[model samples]
Target: MDAVHVHMTNTSNLPVEALENEYPLRMDEYAMIQDSGGAGRTRGGMGIAKQIRAVGPGIVFSARSDSHTVGVAAGVDGGRDGRRARLIRNFGTPQQEELFSKTANIALAAGESVRIETPGGGGYGAPSARPQPRVAQDVADGKISAEAARADYGLSA
Candidate 1:
């Protein structure tokens, strides 16, 4: 496995947004990988989902995040491994395609989008150890679905 990558962009060549006056290479969506965090006495932190849209030409996308298959953080004390991470492109469009875990520079056209889903943290204990209130909060925050809260955490509807 490779270390987490940190990306840097040169702002001088980037096109500015008409309203915000900032480059279009900004964060698009933010969410948690539902039910991905390990279930335990101390629930693991949820993985994050992020999207970035290319608003100009000459943009290139590159990444190789593969927690999706191998699993993310490993749990302790009999806890399980967290879900894997993923990298995808064109999400809702017909062109939507899943990308490899590792990629080099690939040209990105305007209006195209790239999405990344990070793996969740591993839990420290068993699912039964998680408190009901925390499960409820996770549901409200969209970190986990109501069904997951009930099925995984044993929370009531």
Candidate 2:
């Protein structure tokens, strides 16, 4: 029989250095996507973006991801929905393309790249119920923008 591996969740705690050392790839970017979390009194968790570039021969990509077309779940009590996931090929280039959430066997040449943005968690309550201090802190910490604070949480400058 052939060997198979399965995961209980889409999340992984693998470090970029480990991946780069193990595979013929280079980490182009790996960071949390700002404002990707659902807005609420208790805000949802943020999503992450990871971009990898092929640096050697014979690199192929595949994934069975979700939440690309819709949020993880509907928000509760007037809370905003979570941001959806995305898989991009050659991001920031004129030939950039958005790929399917579930796809397999994408050929990657040297210098070509792929980016995956994971879905954020759903919010639990109305965004207006969130405190101004928390919103300000989020903005200060770069979790959300000042404009997002004003628009989503009704915070004033």
Candidate 3:
């Protein structure tokens, strides 16, 4: 698990040691990614990419939805869909990153941090629901499994 503190400005006048003591996780380094969100008719919310240097090994879990789940974008006459959330790790590696994993064993020294970049949600309705054949193709391509397609997306095998 990871925690981040976003301070709008440096007006607190607190020392770095004080801030670190207040937070649960130690901060080795931090940076913000600009303009990571996608555009849609209703305009999707902006995406944020963050890198965290873990002070210790811990578990991580995430769940997020936009128009499809709770109607964040307020579907077009009940046609809008929410954006999907993704989890990736070891980004920019030649082996590529894993989209979703139950657990990751991380060995971090005193000054090691991992990078995480989450994708923005897509538009709802027609664009959200693609052709069944394409969905099957995704299964065949290993992007998703047949059982996962049926279970997650309610698609027929």
TM-score of 1: 0.76
The CA-based lDDT of model 1 is what? 0.70
Q: After superposition, how far is residue 85 of candidate 2 from its true place, in Å?
A: 0.6
Give one digit per residue, the lDDT tens place, for model 3 in 1-157.
0112231122233454665676434544333222222222222233334544445445343423232223232334323333333344444546444444233454444334445443333333442354566556655754445664564445587
Which candidate gets the maximum lDDT versus the true structure? 2
Whole-model lDDT values for every prediction: 0.70, 0.81, 0.40
The count of residue-pair clashes in candidate 3 stands at 8
lDDT of 3: 0.40
The digit string of per-residue lDDT tens for model 1 on 41-121 reads 777777666777887888798765455566468989866666677788988789999888788797889888888777777
Q: What is the Å distance of residue 29 in model 2 from its true position? A: 1.4
Q: Rank the candidates by TM-score, best first.
A: 2, 1, 3
Candidate 3 Cα deviation (angstroms), residue 151: 33
TM-scores for all candidates: the values are 0.76, 0.88, 0.35
Ranking by lDDT: 2, 1, 3
Off by over 4 Å in 3: 1-19, 22-36, 55-99, 124-157
